[model samples]
Target: METEDDVPLHLKSLAAFLIRHHSDQLRSITLSPDPKLHYPLYIDFAELMNEDPPLAHLVFSHPIDYLRFFDDAALWAHKIVFDKLKFEKAVEKIFIHVRINISGSPLECPETFPSIGHVRVKHHGILLTLKGTVIRSGATKMYEGERTYMCRKCKHMFPVYPELETRNSIVLPPSCPSQRSKPCEGTNFHYVENTIICHDYQEIKIQESTQVLGVGVIPRSTLVILKDDLVDIVKAGDDVIVTGILTAKWSPDLRDVRCDLDPVLIANHVRRTNELKSDIDLPDDVIMQFKQFWLEFKDTPLKGRNAVLRGICPQVFGLFTVKLAVALTLIGGVQHVDASGTKVRGESHLLLVGDPGTGKSQFLKFAAKLSNRSVITTGLGSTSAGLTVTAVKDGGEWMLEAGALVLADGGLCCIDEFDSMREHDRATIHEAMEQQTISVAKAGLVTTLSTKTVVFGATNPKGHYDPDQSLSVNTTLSGPLLSRFDIVLVLLDTKNPEWDAVVSSHILAEGEPGKEKDEHLAHIWPLAMLRRYIHFVKGYFRPVLTKEAEKVISSYYQLQRRSATQNAARTTVRMLESLIRLAQAHARLMFRNEVTRLDAITAILCIESSMTTSAIVDSVGNALHSNFTENPDQEYAKQERLILEKLKSFEEFPDIISME
Candidate 1:
């Protein structure tokens, strides 16, 4: 054992600092009886800076040296409890590793390089952090970190270490340097049994987020190494922030292949960002404003909601139903379990069958922006394998790599040019849409990955005017696939003179200085405000149906089943769930957890707009051209009240609702 005087002055100070700040944590590890239960102690770097700035800087500037000191000091801090056991004996099996936590946002932390791409030659051999998505992950295996060998003749132990900050094999001393009254020049050495410092190790590849890169610029990816407690914590498609030492490893040496050094991060701490997607910081002031705004319109909930809805795609004038549907789709519904132990998905899929130049892509882009995490790709640009999951060989090992749906597990995936996709590719999304999971059994690597993503698809019709045919015939989409979408709105180029004049004036008015296209947008929410609100509503409220709401949905569903004609594929048991989900979403949008009859009626109207061929909604004429009215609440009340009365007396009629 090294005496107190033998320990370096700086390391002794570090150990003293550990004892002063984390005596209780150190005491727990020292007092633990089972060696197999060895756990690393987490040290926040912020506290270290407050205690000793020089030491904190030293830990980052020279992590390889300070990290070894951390392991050694952990045992030295508890001489009272650990004096009974030999230092070497105690350290071999139960050494406590110190994982330095940078604290705060990893992206903004001081010790980290700006990003994965910003890492350069100057950043190597130091502590740093990186934030990216894991596109590929390898299987866990045992890694020999350090090895010990004993001289055959002298029986003296000699430690062999690998290259600095690398995974290269350890090189032993050619001759023993031990002095036993004479120089022991033994050429052969005996390997010590059970003297290897091994731990669980895994390799993963991380690609920088596409959101951070410009268009046409491919996202950069780098290799990362996880050890000990860090292994197996992250899988493909997970967004993670890893703190580690920046290092390089030599690629496999081969006759034909050139040897190259690839940069890798040997992870110390890994934090997943999947659950943190909706963790937007909502200020108390904003929350108060939300409460006050809702209170102001207690008698007019729809009006208050319309003010926020207009913010969705303010550039595109009108289309109230489409905006409302977009809001519900983004807010989503409460995912719950039924009595049969089956999990019902809360994700609502929306399909926009529209003509060119009708702002379909604009809605898709705006929806993607509202989501905290989203992937926007065209159907022709992606395939079934790319949309789901695939097993790829990375470093000679077959491992699962996440695709688009898996990558957007907790967010949105917008597919434009939907009709350009081949039929074979479209057929592969059945399980992903309905079950919310992507199962891959390729390459003997069978696994099921979650795809809890909201699919927002926008496709043009096969040709022109086909209102007489079903959506399947018009768009060439299958019945089963059409049923998965909760709402399918059509945007036609009617070429009406009045509509064209209104749209042209709206576009031209934006160029003028004083003229605003629509006065309703004066109170519309901004992108940041809308994002926070969507995250808040999705995370805060879980609405359930009231008796009246339940009755309304059930009655409408029963009537649709009885008089099923056109759009027959759209009306099924799944439609009932869709109605409930949309109603629940509307209730949340209304700032309440209890769905009301009005919410149910609104859900029915949205369903009607998707199911029928009418150019306008029930009361509103030509929904595409409908603008904000003077009294939206009154308008909403009159239309929904009529449906409420009709639904109440639906039992006696031959058909209260029909698909004709």
Candidate 2:
């Protein structure tokens, strides 16, 4: 006759009777001036630290593990629950708790206790309250008036002191008042089951007082899945809160960690949140074309469909930063996946080289997080099988889950530690990068997976870079793979104390991080919106060569000959395509009928700015052919001097000889 909800119904009646006149304010209240800071309840963990001493010299080893145990309310009531708790300037010794019930004992208690009450449990041979107060130490133990009790029915023994009341005797409110008031009411407790209340943004849940289960937190750098409503809040470019079951990061050995959430959650959240409405001002005909393209491509899924690419073609005035480069790179591109996983596909790939601590990893992480599809990172020694094709024994047959490139097929693959990748694995990507597909042959599984991945990768200088500036690709990535990338952005961590101050201030709360990085959603999310924009334009974008644009581009190739040995005409043409595609994409973004002169000009300028840097290097390398052996100290000077010399020589040297 007793169902679970019925028992809660019973307890609700008794709780109301006992607390009918009590004021709600009697619950916990914490005061702190900084709204951003969390005020955690502290306990004297010094005692627990002493009892469970860690390995020598390992102070608070396994902090994450230690944090996990506090889920038990028995631990909360007996060892951790605090009275008048405040951890202001002091290190907050927040003791996490988890409960384990002792059966076959004289204590005739229910299987679990409610979260609000004092749980009576035995630990370390002592009968203790959940608040860490000793109810009854033991018969042989020394305590004030410790009572001994025996249950006749169970024939088991327990130590019970008169001060501790039985659960049936103590009646209270169904819900804790602390969570029912003001801001805490809606945000603090989310109703799950009829009797269960999830606290702390629903990432954590509390059972009855006897048991507290705590799930592990995802790494701050992790890609996590958000719930349906939470996904809606996170629009493209807008920084939205994402909350869901946290999953563990993949280990080096690729073993499963049950601690994290399922991947299904991520796929569903991305699909739902990526939905967008068509721009209102678009022509009816364009809209029809857009719809047709969506239908045709909807079921024909490509790799890398998660990144939102925005193309802005303004002239370069300010110095380039990773944030700026990544933003620029996204303009007019397809976010698809391949054998490599989710990637951003553009006319050109991007390679970033810099010193350590230059915010390279941070930039990559930000882009990967913002992108709709998955972003998989790999390092040196990462195998082709591990990255492109992974085979598993599936029910007596080989099953492949796919590699980072394959998963990123329709999105971007931003690889950190790029130079560390083994040459064989590095070689495997050359085809994928160029052909935009990977042909696999393993265990009789041969197929060409779409690999239109736009690779945004970073690496440290081979050794210590020049103490003065950014590291060049000549030093970090192999020349072959380096050539495959569409654009190579150099991130320099400078010592200009003023810029350093600004960066530090921004990362800290001292200065506002430009526009919250969240406001860009209108231009950022619905990567599908932009893709449709591209699809609409490509149908009629029969881009003819503007005589002026062609001349400007040809002059660019001639200038390249005046500078370096590289046959830059191919590069020049590729850059032209990148510009055309980018122009079309930008035109779409602006709701234009067709690509215009302004669009082409904008694309030309951005592309030329990047190519100019390469041209300068080419000229410099030829002039100083003997001085630089790709060695360290001389490399920067060699490259710089070569560029300057080429700049000077351009006036005298004929274009053909200087170029290739």
Candidate 3:
């Protein structure tokens, strides 16, 4: 009974194509039982539109209307394929979804392409493409789409589709459909819980990638709803491009004046974009400049490495050792799995404890910007659950959510105000730091997640830094925790007039006009190029320690152990491991295939400098006069006894010692 105008042109054409190629699509679907892999037919929208100009014009003009007709056409194709396959009763339960891939001409259409932040009410029911980072993902659950209701008076069964706009509300038919002489009151409708068709549903929050936004601007996020085969397609921290329709849901509670429910994207197809590289598109000239930089620095890797180090936080003057260590930490060592199934973490962990105005937070923020996958968190704000993983109740079911460390997996996690964190929260990262894995046993969920995160922790010392206090005492950190870090650098505000003058000059120069154009300024990589360089090294290079490098490292370890005046608890096997890791990282920075003796020496020098700055050793490389001694707590007692003995000796000379 439908007229020609009532039916969309694209829908009729799509039906004809499905009837023609029904067997081919059905064969592809039957091969894969997994819902994720069950996407057998991918209708290329661009190709279809190109073959039919009228259909393309109709689609381009009325996209939202065409999308609804397209869904119906896909459903009709699904039925045709399902019937042709003659699938078993059990197999029929698994619905094979038909996904539409938009590329070429369709992607060029302005109406189909919209930024995540630009989606509005005008875009409702319109199919659009969006690219963003998945910030949060909810657990998949079965949602009842259609429910059967029975009339209590006549026991008449009726099926109804509930509107899921508001939080918790269901709409029923005004009256029963039974052809009774007397009209039945809609109030007597009883819910039939058993007869319901449930579909897999999930919600995810996608935020604009940092690369797309201007510096210092906060990213915007949008809620996306996935149903049936699309549920659980993506996870947190994934950069994805989704093709879906913009839809809005109404608030369930009509009494509430404020409508809290926002428009959500109902996704049909999701594709993961590579996150290892910078998402920002660069100009042709800028890309060429990066290639030229690589060519110029390919022979002299050490020079290139130094340039990169100096470039990071140039405003913060004079912490060469700390800067170098941070640079190496950014390009971490190679992960290795031994024959015995032991996995050694390749990531480097650095802890910076310094004076109040020494730019510790600045370093952390710079590192976050430099790395492609990085997260910055503070001690006061982050919790044990927030750092690793936590269980949350979503749709009446407990779902595991990823935290900062988990979300920053295979990348960097910068923690500012490290000392201000609670002891309980700090204890949670013990396993994650050493083993590179977080084990969660909460809410009846027992699972271990891979962290693979390099920790960059910055802290302030307790009150004024005392040279007499050990690193642990100064920072209020445990000995075990301190030992885990590959390098612990301390920055002090010393009274060197000459050094202070140099720092002052640099600070003053920053405010001057045309300072960026000064030829005297150190040559540093651009932010985009620097990020790309890091990604290149991490992805392609995996340097191993040579025999000479191994010998150098072994000799240094033995020498440190033999010259120990006090029992060096800090000097453990972990230190030796850290030494090797640093050496490997150094080699990677230089674009070398193997760690040389010079790399090992550089690593040792870095460790020695860190130890000296931390006040663990004196200027001449000897242990300081403090704890790590035999009975350190008894020092006060020893001092008191000596005082008493001295007083007794002075008993004979009462006139020399006057008593008030």
RMSD per model, one decimal:
4.2, 22.4, 12.7
Error of 3 at 382 (Å): 2.4
Where's the lowest-lDDT run of ten residues in candidate 2? 131-140
Question: Largest lDDT belongs to which candidate?
Answer: 1
TM-score of 1: 0.91
Q: Tell me the whole-model lDDT of each prediction, alpha carbons only.
A: 0.81, 0.39, 0.70
Error of 3 at 514 (Å): 3.1
Q: Which stretches in model 3 have alpha-carbon errors above 4 Å?
A: 1-12, 15-27, 33-40, 43-94, 101-119, 130-135, 145-162, 166-197, 207-221, 250-260, 274-301, 394-397, 516-522, 563-569, 613-660
lDDT tens digits, residues 70-114, model 3? 655655555555566665431232444555566555465656677
Span of ten consecutive residues with least summed lDDT in model 3: 620-629
Better candidate number, 1 or 2, judged by TM-score: 1
| TM-score attained by model 3 | 0.75
What are the TM-scores, per candidate, against the unseen true structure? Answer: 0.91, 0.41, 0.75
- Output the worst ten-in-a-row residue range by lDDT, candidate 1: 613-622
